[model samples]
Target: MRAALKWVLWDVKDTLLKVRFSVGEQYCREAERIGLNLKPVEVNSAFRQTYKSYSSRYPNYGIAQGLNGHSWWTGVVQDTFSLCGVQDPALLQTVSHNLYHNFCNAQNWEVFDDSKKVLEACSSLGLKQGVVSNFDKRLEAILKSCDLLSHFSFLMTSEAAGVAKPSSLIFEQALHNCEVSATQVAHVGDHYINDYLASRSIGIHGFLLDRDNKYNQSGIVPKEHCLNSLEELPSRLQEQMD
Candidate 1:
């Protein structure tokens, strides 16, 4: 028989934290504040598109990787601003960079309500909680500051693992951190292709968490077992208990 899962690993960002669009807003606001004469919507839209493009281009690198991954997004903003006939690329990037950096270390870290509820339940049931994410190393400090550190057995990031998701080695490392075999742990995440399918490929239980209605576009619909919020996990546990 297989071991009942003793570990619960988290996917950071949208799964646990309420992602804010404020950084994008701040970029536009800063631009306007200094007479850049650009529309906020344009700035925000460009940032989002560029952000996805950058992430798609480089999955392994993150924020502290010296803007190596998402610099393209910043470049998009700069280029667009120039196209819109705005002067001062340096000021725009500087303010935007500061806003992004400050957001990374912000004290008012917004956490998902579901994340708190389920983590509490897991603890009560004696499951070792952990976080494994494709994020920068500063994730540790952010978790610590948000009071999420203590709840986690260990926080694993791409920087520490030296690899990103959709790769088997990272999942293997996450399992090792929890001292469990792939068959024994379940990974819950928002991205179906990256987190769910990747982990599932390696024999771990992978659950797709649909928060922003992403499943509709993922082309791989999540099953009923793939929940919308962590609050639903207790019923699964309750059924197992029964």
Candidate 2:
């Protein structure tokens, strides 16, 4: 029999909140203003490539020893611009700063339609809720601004934990803070590795939210474990309990 779930841990980006603006489009627009012409497609490709390389090398480097959110994001932005062939140190700094700060504003993001409903449903079920994300300190303010802060009892960030998801350390910290064992917790998020598999690896139930139906073609997850929306979560959890 499955243990009764006492808490639900969540990932922020692409899970509960979706950024309203495109990062690549914003970057290209900023570049054009600075006399640097960049195509959104090319800039996005370069940014993804740079991000993948950094994530591979550092593997949760945001909270890795001695790195804070600003420094980590600055490095990512700088590398993104550099890869896009912007070699001027002054220009790189300017664009990176612009990109980083732009994300700090809540207006740039929107909560998913299903997010609030699911949170309400879970709350009605008497489940404690909290955030476990690879984000930085600014997350608290973002959540507050987005009206989501009240739903969560605690907000754990990469900056606070000094480690990102897919590492058991952050998940362990959440369990410790909630005073619950892994079996009593379940995590919901969009990422297959960082959110679902990572939590499941440590005995926490993991639900993969595939809102776009993109993972339907990927056979890595069982149909029962995959959800098309957060609206399905409460019922799914109830099924497990029964």
Candidate 3:
């Protein structure tokens, strides 16, 4: 039954690796470096609000509306600080620029301890792995700096695909790029709707990585499809395929 699954697609953020610093802490650090005294907690809250607003109004980094990752994220940073009462356009620009470039390197991210093991295990099982994430073009650089880029045969980012999660087009593009049938692949990610439901909607086996037990009682995803850690993945795939 191992032949039933030929590929394993993964989601990057929150599944494989995550930003090492909290948005609030990182933003404050950058802001403080420019001689601005800001509270991390307040900055973080403002960032969350600004992020949700941006995601709703301009999904996929506004790729559909002709905005790229740099433009979209720059707007977010500028507005996040604006919400915090930083009215200096020059200050906003400087902080946003610093934060944007700061995120594209390894110092900004930390790989989950279980991630490498799972990737290696899947490789040993003869399964090809690739990325399907809602990240921007900077993902390749970030992954490379983290030493995780070599594992995947391909990387599909929403900005590059011109489509994002919760939309089946990105997954379809991933399949097309990999030249594989939906039945031959499985996708693992942390978001319930974007990762699990989205991939499954197109006949791909979907697994939800619930490292924090956030979905333990959501009653939305099936228990079998939910994993506490990626370490359960290879064995879980075997069980499902068998």
Say which candidate scores most in lDDT.
Answer: 3
> TM-score of model 2 relative to the true fold?
0.86
Model 3 per-residue lDDT tens digits across residues 173-193? 999977878988999999999
Q: Tens digit of lDDT per residue, candidate 1, span 1-242? A: 65577767788887888545554456666676666666667766666766676566555664445554245345655654554556676776775565545556545368887777788887888777788798776687777766678888887787678788888888888887877677667777888777888888998777778766567456566455477677877666544333
What candidate 2 gets wrong by more than 4 Å, as runs, is: 33-35, 62-65, 214-219, 240-242
Backbone clashes in model 3, listed as residue pairs: none
Q: Tell me the deviation in Å of residue 90 in model 1.
A: 4.7
Tens digit of per-residue lDDT, candidate 2, span 1-242: 76788999999999999888677887888888889998888888888988898777666654554667777778888888888888999999898888777777778898999988899999998899999998878898888888889999999997788887889999999999999889889899999999989999999999999988877558788888889989999998877666
Model 1, residue 156: C-alpha shift (Å)? 1.9
- Model 1 TM-score on a 0 to 1 scale: 0.78
- Name the weakest run of 10 consecutive residues (lDDT summed) in model 1: 63-72
TM for every model, in the order presented, reads 0.78, 0.86, 0.94
Find the 10 residues in a row with the least total lDDT in model 2.
58-67
Each prediction's total of clashing residue pairs, residues at least 3 apart in sequence or on different chains, is 0, 0, 0
- The lDDT of each candidate is 0.70, 0.86, 0.92
What are the root-mean-square deviations of the candidates from the true structure over C-alphas? 3.9, 2.5, 1.8
Best by TM-score: 3
